[model samples]
Target: MTICTRFLNQSRLWKWSVLTVAVVGFPWGVGTSQAGFIGGEGTDNPSRQLKALFAEYWDDELRAGPLEATFLGDHRYDDRLADLSDAAHEARVKRDRDHRHALEKIAPETLSADERIDREVLRFTLDDRIEGERFRDRLIPITQQDGIHLQFAQSVNFHPSATVGDLENYVRRLHAFPRVVDQTIALMRQGMAEKRMPPRITMAKVVPQLRDLAPKNPEESPLWGIVAKLKDWSEADRDHATVAVRQAIADKVSPAYAKLAAFVETDYLPACRESVGLWDSPEGDVHYAFRARSFTTTTLSPEQIHEVGLTEMARIREAMEAIRKKVGFTGDLKAFFQKLKDDPKLKNQSEAEILGRYRAIFEAIDAKLPDLFGHLPRTDYGIRPIEAYRAKAAAAGYYYPAPEDGSRPGYFYVNTSDPTSRTTYTMQALAYHEGVPGHHLQFSLAMEVPGRPAFRKFGYVPAFSEGWGLYSEGLPREVGLYTDPYAEFGQLEYSAWRAGRLVVDTGLHQKRWSRDQAIAYLEENTAVPRIEIVSEVDRYIAWPGQALAYKIGELKIREIRAQAERRLGTKFDIRAFHDRLLSLGSVPLSVLERFMEQNQQTEAEPQR
Candidate 1:
């Protein structure tokens, strides 16, 4: 990894602006400048202590979530859901402020370079949280894609499996659903007051999802089957548990959902702003620009990102045209895209079959891992279907990192709502993005690496984390994974998708583009279906600056790789290079470059 001289200082604030994976939260790790730490500056001891302190604060917060605790392999909170009221959120903010003040005693002059970076990260995150509390982000909480509704669906589907206790916890969570829903609405209202509401187009989809999740008949609900799946439990116990869960669902969860549904239908829908970009919202433009810098870990403006996206799109379009020719399509590229979309053979019929296909892809990808990585995660991984309630709006695939303690495997959820939407041509890239060389391998590796602070293991660096995932997509072809033309097209399609994100995300957030304008940009530029593009565009509008991470990270990683290859000459080993990159877990791109440079020097030294 390369280190940059640009020092992050106390003046900067880290913003939580990425909207792409809202339901999927990011890991907040604290790192300080110190020797013997992953991607550290090899100096500054007290900063290291502070880094440890940050973990305590973060882990304590996670411990409060019964489901999160279980998901993190910390089983103590398995039967509870943390209170989600406004007061609860306020307390959380105060705690963070307290932690921030406590850390302020340590001076930057006393710290090492890496410690300074960690301090900056800590200060930025804390300051951002404080600002967010002051400004309130919860009001604009609903999105067509990620949010509490989707997360609830996931918890009901994924975390409740296995033991009778697990089943019981699921029921408790169901009972707690009312508070959760109410809290979400409260947050949304808070955001609304701050002019931070989710885009009208995005919030439009929230009502249907609420309706889907808030089924009148509990028997027809997604939770009903998840509970029904419990094994070795008695029929009477099951019956009793079912009644309790249903009561919670109907009386509590459903009412809140109904209220929110009404809000969306009546209040929010009418009040919904027509603006497509975050810039149009209250303090939105500035907020989005800040968010862009935070997520890309670069100071590039939206205009710069927009231009970058256009440049990349043009480059990929040329490659796509080559594929079109190779496939013997005499028609224009647009016609070829239509042909691919209309093909019946390109899709699966059922969710199970879609998931099974992903599972097989995982196995195949696993077999080839030895060629690229010297180290691999021992934790098991699963390819599962998204819960029925949320699948309709979920991404084609998403990875849930393995629990911190390793009890639960990392999960890659394949959305099979409309199998045709998850086309066969796109499967390889999806597999790459979510499975090996993508989320699972990179995340699991980061969590287990020895000598790294616990925070680094779980800390999310979007530029580094998601960047690595996007970068991994192209790495498979480097090892000959995209042999088929269609698979190659899939690779291009995925690349096109990320590139398109840059355009539409910027267009929606900074350029005052309409929702339709953003949607049209994606449709014109990529092979993604219209609905997916529309859903994604709305996400960018709600979340701002998040869409920039993929291409930004990919471009940086590729640049570093090219530089390394040029400098190392014939001695460069692709597998070792990748190992060095991933083994440090997720760090800023600058830190990554420095690490890569050190590896070059180490490799260059005389063999003793």
Candidate 2:
């Protein structure tokens, strides 16, 4: 999860444990030498077969998604952008068919329980991906929230420009940017022909963002920041690289962005639907239902979810009201919310001060983690602000997983873009959710899980991952981390804020509420400032059904813990339950429920 787009999940155990990143892994490259499991290549062992299949598929898929590879620190495809044409989509279909056919070759009943879990994780992930392909996510290639530009911008930053060779490879991608942009334009127009375009209002916001992205000169571009970071290059090598980069940005990059901007303003905008909800489009009901099920990992309908959201909003508001009176605030919840918003102590902190606050929260968390969790990741993480370029469109904070090789630490990106408008009281809660016991720990542990197929290890399930992060926000109170009522209030406020998402997100997409109505609903229900309310409402509008994951997942996780506490009684080891839950990385919530239920039956450490 990047600062610009988040809501991904991670795993750890019941009182003790999970990154619920929603990645799909193919089993083509698994090897017997990995930490645990039988290695006989030709042996009929189902686990080995699953591992081998995933390993091989992972390798192929990595090559296929170059930007994904770059983010993962694999540089083999650094010189290229994804080919977003129909041909590429067709090729993906062919690959999916081959992978599915091969997967059908493995017998799940013959596999161990753990392998069976892995098999199902892989199975469902493929099902989701294949169904998504049919929906043609590529059909409408751009959105205000997610699109090629942000992907390119974010991926560009992660490129390791350690050498002139690296610089040249990156320049090659910059040179190829026009073709990708052109392909996206083609897809957008085709989507329009198919009566599928992102809402006009969303596109209106996107056009300006895209227009602002590419500067006329490469030297002025953020794309050159990587080149600027290369300090040790020989003068001749540096000169060669800089010249090539300048030329690429001037001749290819600027023109590509120009072409894209022109297309969006001239062609795409006129064709974009005036309606915001998916219901206005072809097969909109079915599409929104698929998205709802996909993100929540539950078959619950929008109406059901809307009802659930209302219930949750009421529950969280009661917690918030308790805090309001405890804080000695005079008047009603809304008045307290206004005071919380205007309280000078909680706002206007310098970016450094704000960041330092979060870092301190993490250090406090580190000291208490042992008391709270039985296990921890070997890889460490750090806190930072979102890069200036993306901070405007991005959420207030998000987690970036550590590199698999541990070359770099995981990051909790605080959006200091609008520092004055941001709240400091939420830093501790945000830190718990975005740093340490939240995303970084969960993601690292997921990757490190022994004998997990590549997909289960690195892939994502939103309900699992996002739920864990949301669960984590409340976890710090157990460690006495939210020592003050104000801090505790921040936790409850954020919880209600997410709960409000269900109402707002569902209201926007399924109930056919207008943007203004959604914003007003959030303002009435949650304590976030006006700025965040706007973005949160827009985020829900841009990406349907995603916001539901945090609360839905959190409730399920909380329910699991409650079940364990009820059944295990004095035997309920918080650490053990947490560890067992996390041992299965990136699982669907239903799967996690089954697994945790099975764990409750045993007094001993549950085996993976």
Candidate 3:
């Protein structure tokens, strides 16, 4: 319903960063320009042709990715899954090449300013995608944490079985599962042949995940067990669907899973490298460089990112020390972190308490949102625990967008997998980030924008989205949410944790730090639990360069806000500035900066 800027109709979501569901993946779509497309000051307005090109690209890309479309709530491809064979890969490459050529033909100087920005965004998206494909990373499809199998498991949520036809369509997907799984196996074999395997420890995790999803019977499968959600279906229809699903699992799905599980557990796992860093892969340094640039939307090298991370880590630690002193802790910062980690006071003993606290945080934040934002989304959102099936693998919390038509409220999934270890300190910050002013507000506002190109309306840029999410975490501190010192400490700790990421991520992938080194760094610098630290570090190893986006994006946003406030002084209207920023949808930080400066000028000019 809302223009789906989200990716993975082909092979997205789970594989694209898969770190935080709130703002997943890289550069699927960016925000629209503050001004919508209008004819430039000439008769030669190629804006029409350019807009047509974007429409064509969106339509073709969506059709090529039916699962992605379904996730976007487009039912056109509900019955279809991606063709993940060798030919499909080639087709995607050619499609990108052709689109790049088509876009190159459009003269930017002849178009309006907004169209030129769109032109630039389209070119960047295609270029990054083309370069990534050239590396043939698709051959190494499943990492320790992400792969097609996880996507298959989550498709049930993406495709609701509201009607009997929906159930039938899902059964068809079940039958098609073997083909997708087999293609993935072939890709893995190719990756192995090329010596591009993920590290062994990471791969070990992947096999267990595959086992979790590979139910031998249809009744046990997530896809076939949604009997309660299908209230409209008759008993006969449900029974027929159930029987077909079981048979499909017996013949197609289970056998395919068996083959994959065997390939991974036996052959591939042994073949995987012991080293966890991506820098050790074939031409890995170069590949990592491109990814760093793509995710951060900057050409900062691994060395530069590592240095920045170190500097930021030290700075955040100093602030954490201040908090440690505030809490009357006599020992050093590491001791304080250890105490925070062990403190029973920080625990949310039950899932209901965790979810309930998040809901209350949402309500409190909701009432205060109008004070900060000039334009608030009409769309509402809800809070729920991350499903037990995926909770173990999911991050602190993830956000799901509301349908463009408002058929579904947006969802913020709080992970309660290890409840005793799930601290309450981060809940306020996480709630702000995933629920209200963070993802739901920014994403819903983008979807609610009227008359924009479909692509911009539903865009997903990692730096922009995640930057806003992180930036939002601090906004609540100003609004007075973290009342308790521990909660305030949690807020600082969360920020410090992100700062640590800048160091640990770059240290692992670039500096050749071992997985243990990465884990120890977080342990020393933040109060996050050991298991959570292990999971986060593993994610960084599995998906290099992605962790760089949050801090990089947040720093840029805070810089812009600071500069704007400095320049505008008393004229700086936080609400107006925020509304203007949200109005631009999801542009890159650089694009955001330009518009922010331009807006300052607009405000500074004498009244007409």
Candidate 4:
């Protein structure tokens, strides 16, 4: 999943923009450098003008979202945390409006085809972000799945720790944590005043996480991992950095978390709404509608999407049943789900065993990737168990992209909290989806694509990214993976799980389905463990319409591929098709479809 840090409440536009910014020395707003670019050679070149505009926006965004800059491998602002104050949010909105206005002045007809695509994407991004300003998402920042607290706590994992100066910058960020917490509390308080808050049930899950994060012993804090990474440092420097880190955590970090926890437990939790659906909050109906469009990048209404989900569930269920019978299971689908869960052979032996299996699965898939894609990422990836603090509430697996500068590799974090709850059957599908030929492959390559603007390189579109991930789970079948009957069932189960998400996410948020109702639907439809089903339902509750992206995205890609296969017939090449799809980086589904159509026309031309 793309990290949807809810520091600010802008939807897909904010989520991607927050992650895309890079460091440039130019100050925010039309700097002298930008003025020269726009007024110099760009006076006659529309493409240059637009490129200059995008660069200006990148610099402004990096200044505003420093943590994002650090994540992108730009350490210039590593010492600063995001300013979650109301003033900062208002400024961000104004900047987006300004960028949109600048974009509107450009004549798309005069630009090259590639620049036109860039302009359209930027226009869509700015419009969505501007429209999102009217929503109250920023007020209710904390959720079971994500918020300032969780992002800040886990941020150490992304910080550069190769040098002593890097550790010093981390110390500064640790010291800055209290101020961010206070800003977050102020927002939550405003949310309470406006009667906009997360579901009481979901907020209940956050208090413990906050307490876990703010342990009494400073050494026990997640931030201490930074000090642990100082393996090659001189003994004196390591000792000095450790003392500074410990002091900063004890004096600034832990107290801030404790204060935030108190605010949630004593004030925020009791005031949170009993309802789980976003429809219960202010302007919820309108917000849910926008989210559906934003995440899916389609015009489909909630009613239409819910119907699409039902059709997919029906179609995938047929495939699942065939696999069940192939394994000689006499029981029905629901019984088979239980059998899969209860069988010891299907459960993980240990955390080490889970990590080892994932590594092996990734290696096997890596060897086969050349047959399916023309290009692969130069960035490598690692498999690590999700940190113990957040593992309980985390997903089964998630992929975080590597930095563009190669300071670190992408990591696939597997939840080894409850080994028994994790199944061996789903491991291959999980590995493929989160690691090889999936998010790592797609995201890392997007970052590495040449000549793309910084925003396009690092930006994420949920439908495009998640849809590709879901599609990748099945792509291995063409290369002779998932030959095991049970593993094939696992792949089908994962497909069903994503399909079930479309139903459950819409059901909870749009149809007023109770939390239990959503859980019950997944429990009956997919072979996912009960614990995972409950967690998935809560995720859908916390993040409305996000789950819909996987199935919706996958279906569109599959449709486009089928069209290509028919058009090219025996001339079709899967490797070239994949290379073309990914080479465009993260685009809206509409943009992707248009590009693919143009490519097909070009391919069909009589002569080169």
Candidate 5:
């Protein structure tokens, strides 16, 4: 039964009823003891059998294409590419299923704490995949928001550089673009028959992007941007690269664009569904609700989540209003929002200037981290512009995890495609959220946590991961940072953005709100530009229930932190609390609460 069902039925159950439940115990489970399980040496060392498994996984994953490797910081696979074929998808599913099957045979009681957590993450992930596959998601193909169109733009924007090798890699990958686009088209076609077509409005946006990138003269294409930067290369090498890239564009890339555009504009557009949310699909509502529970790692119902979103929206608006009043704006909050949107000073001169601004924000915030965070990420992080192809449809910013072996640094990709849309007031919180205190810090720290399984260290529960990022944003103020009022307003803006996400995400999915309605809701409530709101609404439409995670996760973390502070009082060391939180990496709220309770007990005990 669902937790809600259990809650409703609790009144009828005998108060003292007892039932056996499976629980991890002793050598079979990793508990407080750090002991290694299954014929292992030290507690930190996995059993030799598990070590072999780890090595095998590393090798297999490293062999994934160059883009995947580069994203993961594996330089070895830089020349290769992701296989988007049906066969590749099948292989991926089989691999996950096989791993889950193999893991089920190993008794959980025989694993250490780290190993136990790793095992659970893998099982949960595999279970989700198996369940997800049963739904036959292919019927829902081609959201205007995806496809290789945006990816090509992204590469041109970010990959062009001074180094010959860097330029060559960009050109090499551009040459291979046609095959990748074909793969994407095949996947979309499979989705079309399944009734999974993207909304017509989104597919309309795809055509313009194709036109912009598919230049009649190959020299004018974004690939030519790399050619422009090849000054240092030897004439022969440069000629070779230029020829290879031009041919790829003319023969492979351009034709691929023509095919996809024709398919989207002519074929798929007619069959696209009119419904706004997945709730319209077969058992769509049930799937979305399940996803909500999984993402938040809680038992919140759609109604409850909707209500919480409403509450947060009101609270954040009031805060923004106060900022407006402090700044002595004679007009109302809405007026101020409009003024900020139109102000010419808000726009950056160019994309490079935007990166420099973000770098400054990172440096400014780094000076303040020591005041609040007891633990910090060891991996270095750098800022990069989002590739042009994806930039138009991508989030304002995102963080990529650093390579495990430390060869490549973690990257924070900022989308500066629309300079007018990027505002300085928001940069402080954006950097913190995507870089330092946000994703990279939490993710990189999790990767470095000793005595944890590789999976647990790298695994994500969206509620846990995104919740931490949202939670990290407000933490700076609590630690006596964000002294600048505008910066604090930026934080409030960030909070408002997440709060808006909850309302809009649920509003669209459960309430069947229209795309325009969702976009209008964001504009009325926040200072974000109309274009961004449109794109964001489309994103939520494409990927239902994901945006809800930010606010829901943040609220839970904040709730727990307040509970911990109140209970421990003077004994609560902020640093120690942070340590406990980070030490466990990403865990469900239930596990986090348990950890807090354990810490409280430790605090209550007298020191030796």
Candidate 6:
């Protein structure tokens, strides 16, 4: 699942909130002595010192980012929203710097191997965030894909409203909307003065979303969903909560959205830059270089990545040509792509058909999961249509991991916004990537990994997570799932799409390729629908260096697996290999490679 810059920024805070429930111990026999050290002085014991520091940082993070806390199922701060003000941004930067300083002072040599890994992960996270401060990301928070407005509109889905107090907390957050909106506008205004605005075209997309979110009638507001679901409460209590929620929506939330829309259309949109690439902005080259390194968790320059993309695309094209010939398709590979896109029979008949097929696909995939994975997540997942308001700007699909408390199941949000545009063959590959054996499986297992700090459990490294997702699409083929040539072609199409991202993203950013040029390249190369290709290009424009993570990550993962297979000969177990990878949680590519090298001789025993 691709993440926007706003979501990425918030994820740093979200990653640090500790789960409220006790996670089941990992079956691999990793000792949990360090996990028990939540706080206290541990100057003499570096392991204890590092764990205590992690605990402290976690607490600070939750306090600083209450919304993120709520998302993590830690309800202590459910009544509050995050501080989006400049002071909050400054404080966060200082806190990250301080944490890094504290981390560096700890003696890594004195800690256990696990604690050392934690120290390095935390250090890397801190340095990345600190380095990002110079780019002034906080100023340009609004984007076509994500922003404060869109997050608030979807609050009812993620925010708990099971009880009266939860309902009241939801209402309080509604009341708090205006303040956050104003804070966002202030930041955007500052962005304008500093010349750090988003592209005018992307900002144009935000205007309609804000207008759609801001309704004159309170009952019509998106936040009204919570009030509508208060059936368990006493009638009088429910009535009170309903009234309060409606009033908050009418008086606070709607106006706030309307105000934001006005500001964007009248003030900010006009000031937005015409150029799309990061290279066009001040210090953009340096910023793009940093993002490329940070997102891929590698030091490879954009030129090297672009060439890797070109090579991979060529290989994938050959594979696609073989598939086209296998299917007895006429004309060139591009013609085959066009036929795939233009075929009405390839499209879903209705949204229900689209969702129902995904459910069936996952059910079949779940039964076969044990053939490849020894350890599976206890947390379950479900499929849902992407909410209409933001679906146009969103990706094909994305996974939202269940809160560690298991208050809700993880979700794979499919974009059924235009059902006919949803092709039939792509369903299996998309399902595998976004749902089981992809994000839901990887993320749920990560959250359950025992004795890890909150950051390690919940933090996302795009290369690892997205790489795993891309790798998952192809994993099913080995299990003989994609039997139909069209289905296998679908998988290849998605692979080509990700491979295309490596080229298109760098092309737009580093090579200074025009947005149209990137779009044309993707159109000619991949079988992805035209609408999605356009959306993806704009996404790359809005979030630089992120698109490079998928193929780069997949290639690294595949490389490691190939090495393992070669070393272990017939003894190599795919299930154990998968378990070990998931057990590490989401980490840097470098960290993952180092772990694999050190543990090459010591394999994780397969779970019975």
TM-score of each: 0.86, 0.92, 0.92, 0.96, 0.81, 0.94
Point to the candidate with the largest TM-score. 4
Q: Identify the superior model by lDDT, candidate 5 or candidate 6.
A: 6
Error of 3 at 270 (Å): 0.9
| Candidates sorted on lDDT, descending | 4, 6, 2, 3, 1, 5
Q: By descending TM-score, how would the candidates be arranged?
A: 4, 6, 2, 3, 1, 5
User: Taking the tens digit of each residue's C-alpha lDDT, what string does model 6 give over 514-602?
Assistant: 98999899999988898889888998898788888899999999999988898788888899899988888878899998888667656
**Tens-digit lDDT string for candidate 5 (115-213):** 665665556655666666766554443344543465454344334354556656665676677777777777777777666555666667677667767
2 against 6, candidate with superior lDDT: 6
- In model 2, where do residues sit more than 4 Å from their true spots? 1-45, 604-608
What is candidate 4's lDDT per residue for 1-608, written digit by digit as tens? 33333332334234364233334442223455575343343455677679888887776777786776776667788999988888888888877877887888899998988889888888888887777778867887778677778878777877878888889899999999999999989999999999888898988999999999999899999999998798899999999999999999999999999999999999999999999998898888888998999889999998899999899999989999899888899989999998998999899878988988988898899999999998999998888888888777788888877776566678888899988778999989888888889988888888777777777777777888889999999999999998898999999899988888888888888899999999999889988999898887888888888888899999999999999999988888999999999988777899999999899878967784
lDDT against the true structure, per candidate, is 0.68, 0.74, 0.74, 0.83, 0.66, 0.81
lDDT of model 2 at position 446: 81
lDDT per residue for candidate 3 within 1-608, as digits (tens), equals: 01122224312322121111111221233224311222222223477657656665665666666666666666656777878788877877776777788778778888777777677777877887877875677877886555667667666777767677787787788778788877888888898999988888877877766676677765666665655576567888877776776787778876777789888999889999999988899988888888888878887898898888888878888887888888899999888888888889888899888988887888888888888998899988887676665566557888878767556788887788879999888788888877779888888888777656667766777788888888888897777777888877777777877788888888888789999999988888888889888888887887787778788988998888898898888888889988988888776677888988888888878898
Lowest lDDT block of 10, candidate 3: 14-23
Model 1, 221-296: lDDT tens digits are 6666666575557878777766777777778666767777887788777777776667767677677777787678
Deviation of model 1 at 193, angstroms: 3.9
Against the hidden true structure, what lDDT does model 2 obtain?
A: 0.74
- Give me the runs in candidate 1 sitting further than 4 Å from their true place: 1-48, 63-67, 104-124, 127-135, 158-171, 234-239, 349-353, 605-608
lDDT digits (tens) for residues 1-608 of candidate 2: 22223321110011011122222232234334432222233446666667666665666566566776677666777899887778876776666666676677789888888878877776676677677655655677666666777777666557887777788789889888988888888888788888877888777877766776778867766677777766788888888888888898889887777788888899889888887787877788888888888888899999898888899889888888898888788799988888889988889568888887777788888999987778889878877777676567678888777656666777778888868888878777788887868877677888877656555666657788788888988887887888888889888888888888888888888888998999888888877899888877777777777788888899999999998898877877888877887778767888999988986776545568
Superposing every Cα of model 5 onto the true structure, what RMSD results? 9.3
